[model samples]
Each structure stands twice: as structure tokens, then as C-alpha cells.
Target: MKIQIEKEKLQAAYKNACGCVKDAFEKLFGEDVLETAKPTLDDYKTIKSYEDACDVLGLSPILSENRNKALCAQFPDHYDFRQNMPKHIIALMKLEIISRALWGKSFEPEPDAEGNKIYWYPWFALYTKDEVDRMSDEERKSLCGALFGGAGHGAYAGFGYLTADGRSSDSGADIGIRLCQETEEKAAYFGRQFIELWAEYLAYGFKVTEHLK
Candidate 1:
């Protein structure tokens, strides 16, 4: 079926999903965890200067020169602004909510085979219900697994987040987020919940409307 989702319905579904995640974080960790990890919208910005790049989520220069050789080396394709910046920003927003859910608990630090620290991060992406239903399990893994930009790749089409176990986090920003679960059993339940949500709210729209048939 061609799943149709209304804008208000989609927004509501997302809000509920976010609430579920937020509650799960509180249940696993504590009430204050997500609150602390949540940042003001201004926290991340696309700026013209490389000096500010490190301090922001992304960088888009007012001047072409601002995205210098160093930034090109650092952020690669993402340093420059694109038509898809809004989508990218939205992904980052969802990531924050999910990451905050992970905050407050401590997971085991998984080291690489070489004993180097392997940083794991959650990879979240939104697909239409019809889009997700068309893909096989393997296809889903291959496609949505790492939709985020990797260390050196371009912003959109390169690679996504790193995963060691079922879930991961950057050791630098908030290690405790990964450790939010009070018990090891539920350590990374957020990953499962999001994947089951089946393209976030798109699935919910179908469920609520009984329109999947």
C-alpha cells in the first residue's frame, strides 16, 4: 500500500516516540540525564570560520574561503552548505534525543582488536513506511545502518555512525549517556525501540489509521 501520512499526524507520532525514548532514559538512568544532554538550538551552528567549526555541529562558510583546506580535510563535503542541510539538522536533532536517552548510564568501554578505544554511536534515519516495508532485513541494515557522515566521507552518501555492540556513543561528549540503563539487560533498548518504530512515525500513521491493508 502507498502509505500516506499527514503532517500533523507525523509530528504527533514523532512527539510520542520522543516521549517514549525520553521516558525510557529516565527509567533506565535518572530524570536529569536527558535534560542535561538536551542543548539549545543555538548550541550547534554552521559557521564561516574553521576556528568555530570544532565548536559547532556543522560548518557552512559565508565566504567560500572559510571552508579552507583544513576544513575540507576535517569535515569533507559537510563543511559546505547544501540543499539538504535541513534534513541533516533534523537528523542531528533526533540523534540528540536518542543520545540523551543513553546519557546517565555507563556501558562497558569496548576496545578494538588492537586495544584502541572503539567509539560506538547510534545511527538513526527516517524512511517512509512504504519505503521501509519494501526493504528486506539485510537491505535495511545496508542502507540505514550508517546514514550519517563518517570521519572522512562526505556528508550524505558516505557512511554513518560506528557501532560496536548494539549501541554506541562518542566517548568525548557524554559517555554516561550510553550507560543510562540501570541494568545491563536494558543497556541499549533505545536502538531496538527506534528500529521497531519502523521509520519512526510513518509506521505509527499506518497503525493508527488501519491503512496498511
Candidate 2:
């Protein structure tokens, strides 16, 4: 709900999270992708708290119903309500979760990290599927191109490692999930922690200011 954390602390935490995601990306893919993606505090800070971050980037509250309709019409063979859907929709959803974890909430599992009740954002599940029978090859290829640009291959392929279902993975679709998870989780953890640490830092700043007064 309401964040009691200080702004400066949150900012620092968010930055650290971004760095972690960036590092992961560099490790899995290469520095080239990170250089192009260039995820930053300003890009993530727009998403306020964990919940808001989750809803906006994780779930993608931005694209309206009309947009979906248009996408479906334009790519009829690839866009299937029952199957393919739009790639952007899925991308937005994954982004929201990453944002939530980094900016809004902490990663908490019921029993701990190894628990079955490990609640993950939606995109993690989506990328694990086999062929989207609903969409045509052209549609899938186009969606991949649009979402990933030049860095799509390695990122998409990396999802096979992240997901449980390795055999049924799509390179284009999985890359979005991999990148989002890498970025958002770090941002959320650091943002919340930074706030707590900043409170102490501010107390010292206040004392110094008060002495001057």
C-alpha cells in the first residue's frame, strides 16, 4: 500500500536492482544487449510502489481493448484469442512484474526461496509454453522482431534455463520474460531496502542542518 520509505533511499535501491539485472543480462547474453537496452532509474522510477510496478509493467495496464483488436486484425493468422494473442500484451505483463519486485514489493515465498508457493509474475509462466498453435510462423517472427529488435536471439534462448519446461520454449517470446525478470526483481528489492537505510542517512543530514541553523 503506502510506502513509508524515503525517496533518496528508494532511488539508490532501484539503481542497484537495475545493476543486478544488467549484470545478469551481460552474463547470459553479452554487454551489447545491455548497452542497447540501457535500463535506468528514470525508466523504472515512473512505476512508484511494488504493486503499481507490478500492475503497470507486469500486467500492462496501458494497452486498451481497441489496440488488441487492431493487433488481432492486422496479424490474423498469428493472433489467436485462444492461443497466440499479441506479443506486446505478454511483454507488458512481464515488465510489470519485474517493476513490482524492484520498485514495489519484496520477493517473498511461503516457506522460503525453495517453497512450492513461490509466487511469480505472469510472464515467467507464459514463456515456458511450446508452439503457440494459434499464431502463424510469420506472426511469431514479426512479434519477436518488434519486441527484441537486434538482441532477441540470446535473450529468448536464455529463457529455456529459467523455465521448468525447457523443451517447449520459443526464443522470441522467452527473451522478454528473461530480460524483465532480470531487471525488475533487483529494482524492487533495492528500492524498498534503500528507503530504510535512507531514513538513518537523513537523520544525520537533519542534525547537520539543525546545527547550522
Q: With candidate 1 superimposed using the best TM-score fit, by how many Å does residue 176's alpha carbon deviate from the native?
A: 16
Any idea what lDDT model 1 has?
0.38
Best by the TM-score measure: 1
Q: Tens-digit lDDT track for model 1 on 1-213?
A: 877656434433343455577566557545443332222223221111123332343323332333356547765656334334444343343434443434323333433434344344333334567887899999877765455334233221112234453233332322223323333333334434344332332232323222321
lDDT of 2 at 82: 23
Taking the tens digit of each residue's C-alpha lDDT, what string does model 2 give over 84-191?
A: 445444444434354444533443222222222322222211222344456789978876775558543434423233335444332334433322333445534433
**Candidate 2: segments with Cα more than 4 A from true spot:** 1-157, 161-175, 178-213
In model 2, state the lDDT of residue 19: 60
Give me the displacement of residue 138 in model 2, in angstroms. 43
| TM values, all candidates | 0.23, 0.18
